[model samples]
Every structure is written in C-alpha cells, then in structure tokens.
Target: MGLFDNAVPGGNITKPLMIALGALLVGKMLSGKSAEQPQEAPAPAPTPAGTTSADGGLLGGLGGLLDKLRDAGHGNVADSWVGTGQNQSINPGDLGSALGPAVIREIAQRTGMNEQELLQQLSTALPGIVDKLTPNGQVPQQHQVASAFNS
Candidate 1:
C-alpha cells in the first residue's frame, strides 16, 4: 500500500497531523543515537521513556501506546486511529493517561509548547496521523515510516 493510504479522500495532505508522529520518531532516533555513541562528557538529556531510537521502534512504540489506550478501556477510540476512515474524537484526559507524564512532557518540549497546549494538539491530530501511518489497516514497519518521510 502507498504511504498516506489513510489520508483524507480527495488527496488531502496529512502533513499537519504528522507533528506527533514526527516527534515520536525523532525521540526514538535521537535516543538511539545517543545510546550507540559512548559519550564520555556529561550525557545529553534523555528522550522520554517509552521512546526508542530504532526506526521502526517509534511506530511499534506508538502501537503500544494505542494498546495502552485500549487497555485503559478506550479500544473503540484507539481503533478509530488505525484505518482510513473518519477518525473518532479522543478525549485529552484519556489521551493523557495513555501517553504518561514523561512521554507527554518530552513531546511538549520537542514541540516547544506547554503540556496543556500540546495535549490539545495531540488529541486533535494523532488519530489522523496514525491512520495515515497505518494505511494497510495495520501498524507499519520502520522502513515504511522512513520511506514515508523520504517521500
């Protein structure tokens, strides 16, 4: 399947929603690189927990994040973020519980927004972005997300 398979019909670009996805991926890549590099000097600030540096790790971690949502009794909402369909609304309160403090805080830092504002943005954007990522109605692999970035 093509990248952005779940984008809005009529070929609308999903770029705006990519913010959360991009932040998650960047968290993974940056953390992974630091892990690989044996830094002798004072270590850089770590990426938040629940993030990894591997290319696919970000998507996988996001899938896990969705799972957390489901496990938190929001399966229907989580499912809405997966396929190319009308994305259901997500409650920021619920999303916050699923994302955890560290991850949320880190994302806020990465996006240069305050936590409350970041949460609001994420609640609005994540479903569409994740739907775009999982064009095949399933979680995409690392390379797929990478190719999407390049494309």
Candidate 2:
C-alpha cells in the first residue's frame, strides 16, 4: 500500500459514489431538510456545464470529480466504494490530495464548510454512503447517479 492505494482490504468506491456522497452531505447542510421531501420551489434539473461529458449535468460534476480522483491515483479507493463486499475508509488528508486544491476549494465554498471539516465529514459518510448507492456491487450509470440525487 502506498500514498494513493486503498487503505483497507476488500474496500471499493468510485467516482460517482464519492461525488454523490459529497453532494449529499452538502445538501444535508440545509438544516433538517430531507432531500427526499418535495420542495416549495423544486430545484432545477442538472444541465451540462459545457459541451463536455464531465462538465455539469446534475451529477456531471460528480462524475468529473471522480475522474479527477482516478487521475490522481486514488481510483482503487474510489472503486472500492463501488465494488462488492467491504467498503474502505479514506484518510481526509489523502482525499485533499486526490481531489486537488481547486475542487476542494469549490466544494468548501459550496458547502460552507471549512476544508478540514468537509473532508472529515466526507470521510465518515463516503464509505457507507457509496456502499448504499452501489447495492448491486457495481457503479451506476450516469442517469442512475442523477436520479439518486433527485430523489
């Protein structure tokens, strides 16, 4: 095991799972508002940020974020979250490096949580959260990813 290697055995997570977990936590910041409830003003559906596949279509950003992590050499940890069997735990420090500064800053700004706090919360939630998302022991498709957030 090295810097970007999966810290736990049989652990698996993926881009979609991590991004969804982060987004889910951010959404949870809305003071007791359950994401499952219908809202007074329904949120806008996700749209592509640009003409790219990894831009912004609801979960598009998340998908892109996952790509970044994989590119950063944390794919194994991410995949473990999506893979079958036991999910792995992540080090908050490693997460910062895997996601890089820009993305971390963006998430921090959006969630209104400091970098360390956000990472800490994300680390705790990500493992179990992603496990739930990939119940079939496989990463979900783009549409399935988006639908989970919408509902």
The pairs that clash in candidate 1 are: 28-52, 28-53
List CA RMSD, all candidates. 6.0, 9.0
TM-score of each: 0.67, 0.59
How do the residues 1-151 of candidate 2 rate in per-residue lDDT, one tens digit apiece? 1211343233443333333353433332222332433332334323323312222432344455456557778878777777886676789888777666655665554444678887876676666655655667766665665455445
Best by lDDT: 1
Worst 10-residue lDDT window for candidate 1 reads: 33-42
**How well does candidate 2 match the true structure in TM-score terms?**
0.59
Query: lDDT of all predictions, in order shown?
Result: 0.60, 0.52
Candidate 1: regions farther than 4 A off: 1-19, 25-60
What would the TM-score be for candidate 1 when compared with the true structure?
0.67
